[model samples]
Target: MNGNRNSQDVVVACSRGITPGMPSFAEQIAKSAPDAADIKQRRWIYIPYDRYTDRTGPLTEQSAAATGVVIVESTAKALRRPYHKKKLVVLISNMRHFALEQAARGVSVLYVFSPKSHGQALVDVQREHALPELTCMTPAERELRLDLATAIENGLQMKFAEDTTWASRTADFTEVYGTYKPGKSYVMDRFYRKARQKTGILMQNGKPVGGQFSFDADNRNPYKNQIPVPKPPKFRPDPITEEVIAFVGETYAQHFGEIDGFDLPCTQADCDLMWRFALEHLLPHFGPFEDAMRDDHGQLFHSKTSVLLNLGRLLALDLVRDVAQAAEAGAIPLASAEGFIRQLLGWREFMRHLHGETDGYRLLAGHVPQEHRRFTQEVSPDRTEEATKAYASAISKADPYAGARPSALGASLPLPAVYWGVKSGLHCMDTVVAQVIQEGWSHHITRLMVLSNLANLCGFSPRELTDWFWFAYVDAYDWVVEPNVLGMATYADGGLTATKPYVSGAAYINRMSNFCGHCQYDPKKSTGPGSCPFTSLYWTFLERNQDILAGNFRLQMPYNTLRKKPAQELMQLRARAEEAIAHLQSFKRPAY
Candidate 1:
């Protein structure tokens, strides 16, 4: 898998970002055991819109062997879908810096600004250079993979090198659990423990450190403004980044997020500084406050490295290794270290494998009958041609399945305007959306508990919510958001990714944060005009889904409590829940 197919004039096509420390597949191909004379020269190509990595292998060999390197920046690809302006800036700027760094190593680097798809760009490069064959790491996305397959059909002789970006490989997932079956539930804890055993991370004498595999229970202390939340260190834009910011600002002016004060890491040096800041100032407190949300402080102790990690600026396993060492050296708590590692090795890896196993849940989407389908939404009439094409091709195809199980509670409502910028009376919902509008990022808790939770309660389409996450978040990719949103967040997969829907009542929100204090609605009330929307909706959700959820072992207490409610009171709560949904859908301030 590491070696390349035999070719005298093979062009190595690199992805968007390549880790300096890690040997890319192109580098591996360069070092493959081939006669020096038979391999005349190697050409390299880079497409910046592709997706993540770091390892210590054959970097010098690849750079020295390459005759030329082409880094293509596709404006058309950037315009293909609605993305947060900040996300585009980060990706394009990082790509630009990466190209300059590669060129500095004495390689003949050609930077191209293309207004075409990646496949077309690569084909053009091959034809221009007279390269006989093309090779690239298997793309991380389905659409891109399909595009490449089409290019191959159109006379581009290409070979796909194995994708080695993730902490856990596809084989590792298969080893843990045999080939994934539809409707089969996979437990994250089991996979996390097995991964720990395989990697020996945070382990001593063949057992987990701190005498356990997870410290998740200890990592959920809600923030009460008691600890000083460190401001994320800013990386001032260099001239290259400044140019990219200006370009993205004007070109993507209609995009979702803000571009002013763009301070994300655009180079390996900036990424290093950000990592160091997390180690010194953020990791120690990250565990307890990992689940906490604050209105004033959007990212409390969270290491906002997902953007960098996904962009191949930082490696997931590398971070996990460093965190374990830090914990062992007493630089951070075991809970904090374990909590962070769980994300990289457990959730991130699990999501990737599951996404592939399920064909990005497209199989489930394809199964839904047309008459019952509400998942597909039309592209907005005002969108640009590229954006419209992207939305129509992606969204309309995501037709959610109507599973045989009652637990697959059908949620068919369209995503509300509140998600886009309209006012919702709920303080938590409005506050999180405001942050997403500005930064295109929020901690995972806010995503699950506030955004996805409310959407589920209000019966919003899972596909719509999933696409929104894909476009709106800086850290989101299709592989990451599909499992997280459809399975864990909304339970659209019917216990495939998670055992139960991560829904909560207003009490949980009030217990976790101060949002309820600022709202006019009563968190304790489950009925009437002044009742908190979440509180009212919580009971109604239980009542409505009772047929599906009553048999679940985890819902015994909630169902028992629901059964105790008087019939008249239940009717009133349902009416209030409907009123709350209407209030949210109104796209104006609540008429208090």
Candidate 2:
């Protein structure tokens, strides 16, 4: 329905369920509505946490006013995985604020505080309102989409409106990539080039504006004390946000990250300001240092816009168009503009498209060695406190390479405590993990080059690492994290998402980041006590997986190097890898 529809034409439904320890804004709204009983009977629009704003989709103030709005706060959903505390605070607080904004706009809002899951809460709303039909936009994550589809199949009169927030839709993805083929691999460059042509972004006179679709080659210069990195925009929590912080702190005490310094944009206005900050301050240097990491700066030259974009506070197309205009106007360099556009119109869209097209977890499930596949059955939910304790106990007591027999192949080691926040004696890991713990934010480079790379080398279960990423990052969702962790970083999907595993020893890490300088292990060494774990593990991983990886052309150089290494040297590298794994397994975790 259009935004200008009359109130008599639509009914608004609101559910009054609040997550525990949080104030019931929905309940307060219900009590204050002009006709509470009449409001209950009206058809209502339901706004999930991910769709809390009107800027992205069809949910404008006038439309919401016609049929009332249902905003639900569900404890069950938040606890599905012990999400980063800052992530919870951002999501719940933005949702609460959106409800208040709607109420202030003369829209009858039913804010529900439910102890049940979001699905159950929606069912409650359907029954309470006696509604024959409910309308919601397609959810971003596949799991939620499937849940809603099942509800529809089971006789819920629900209609899904098209999601208009993204730059590209599912049909567009299909047009470019066709249907997903199980064992076939897809390259991102071809998809990116097609998207650029289809969208006419950075195109001039029927050609790319700069005669090239990507400036990635020009975008990898490390920060060598050239220009000072601009600080990312930070919003001080207002009273509403402070209350959210307090609530999240008390309720999700064990969740990762502290909520005290939560500074993410919660409103459209805040999002706009952050966007401007990114364009004016960060965008210029963003391209050159996009792959660079620093020990002192966690956000270094990166646009902290992913969280806002994922949360629906900012629309992707709008941001991309504005960025393109700035580039066209010569406000930012071509490399900077192209790099940013590539992320928005290229990688981001590609990941989301792949996520919808395939079962990423299922694709990797078959490739995991039988012994490691059973590891999933043994562990609880991979990131919970119980799972952490269990994994720690197992690692400490069990042989580090117990199941990884026949040359340490099919290694399925559980994630260690070091991944969360403990000192791993590796400066790169310790620094990045600490950043993830404190801020729940890290740029793409830190995630792939440092975090996921180390996890892959350590032989951690791909699913376990993927789950940990889902629980840890603010920008993480099932759709994004699964493809990235399994397909791109770890190559657990057997290179369906990447041409080759993005694996490297300390040389690559040191080249891209300042992390190795502070590390206890020498980046140049491969087998000594001070040997870099990544360096030792790098050779070992290549040796163990050589039979499987030999045919891949991209891996030929690495395989050649492995072949050239002396037999005794290869054996010593294996011994070093075993020692490293054992040490990592037995390392004591310190209380943070």
In candidate 2, stretches whose alpha carbon ends up further than 4 angstroms from where it belongs are 1-43, 61-64, 153-155, 360-372, 375-411, 588-592
Clashes of each: 1, 15
Residues 358-461, model 1: lDDT tens digits: 77776554443211443343222224454333223354443222111112678867778888878777889989998998888999999999999998888887
Q: Which ten-residue region of model 2 has the weakest summed lDDT? A: 1-10
Model 1 reaches what TM-score against the true structure? 0.87
**Model 1 whole-model lDDT (C-alpha atoms):** 0.72
How many residue pairs in model 2 have overlapping backbones? 15
Candidate 2: tens digits of C-alpha lDDT, residues 1-592: 1112121111121222234565445444555353555465545666757766677554653454465676767654565566888898888778877777777766777666654445556776667766557677777876566556655665666777777778888887788778977666778888888888888888987799888888899999888889987877789875567766766665556666666678887766787899999999999778888999999988888887898888778888888888889998989899999999999898888998887786544433344443334443122121333223322323553532121111113557877888778777889988999899888889999899888887778788777777788878898887788778777878777777788878899999889888888888899998877889898889988887887788889999989898999989988899988888787778664432
lDDT of 1 at 1: 11
- Model 2 gets an lDDT of 0.73
How big is the RMSD of model 2?
Answer: 7.7
